[model samples]
Target: MKNNWADAMRKNVHHLAGSLGNLLVESFHYLALFAIGGITAWAAVMAFLGMMEKGNITVDDILLLFIYLELGAMVGIYFKTNHMPVRFLIYVAITALTRLLISDVSHHGPADLGVVYLSGAILLLAFAILVVRYASSRFPSAKVPDPDATVKGALTEEKGET
Candidate 1:
């Protein structure tokens, strides 16, 4: 009897510890998300302000803003669904590479082969995005049921619907 009691106590303690650890990790996860979202917003605003001050919005500046927009969208989606969309990262990479390629060409007159490499990289990333999309659609994972749908289902059952 003593050994059984001791085993129960140990199991309870282990479960409690696991719960507390999960809580701690979840809290930190949320905090980090908020921080990243806020920082992205701030940087985007600063970039816009800088462009306004210069009174000129170049393609590079626009591309940078697009990058920031993608990042903010990514954070928002992750916050809502707890799932990060890989395509957004790919979009950002494509935008960044395009921006770099433009800057390099404009400054260096396309004399070097960097432009070719950057264009190739952008093409590869674009292909990767397509592949990812195709694979996701082809082998879709189980999806979480919508909470609103669950409530609606309960209401329908209460009304004697089959």
Candidate 2:
């Protein structure tokens, strides 16, 4: 009985600590999001104005599009899910690699070219795994309850119902 009581107390303390920590962390996240959103909005407006004034569309303009889009996506996802996932790291990595490749491919040698190509391949594989994992997790074996319908058939039935 004493050990059980101790364990219960420990659990309660652990839960309390976790709750407080999460509250502190989320508060910081909200502040950071507000600051970043303000700065990004200001910068995006300035960049659009600059592009229009120049009359020449540089790759920098396109880069700005991607940066703002990804930033917005990251912020939106956090608000929706209340937390970020490891899968987003793959997306960010791929985007960063693509940006680097686009900005510097002309200045690279054969070895550098191979490295960039390999980086792209690895990113592709990571994205494929992420897709498969997300798909399987979201839509598990639908035929588990009724074996007569194959998984694919069950998925088709699900789609039809939806």
Judged by lDDT, which candidate is best?
1
List TM-score per model, in order: 0.82, 0.52
For residues 1-162, what per-residue lDDT tens digits would candidate 2 score against the true structure?
Answer: 999999989988986887789789879988887787777677778888888999997674676667666776777687776656445555666666666665565456435656668577767868776786888799864543533345457678879963
- Expressed as tens digits, the lDDT of each residue in 1-162 for candidate 1 is 999999989988986887789789889999999999999999999999999999998999999999999999999999998999999999999999999998888877744777778889999999999999999999997998865577678879989996
In order, candidate lDDTs are 0.92, 0.70
Alpha-carbon RMSD to native, per candidate: 5.8, 11.7
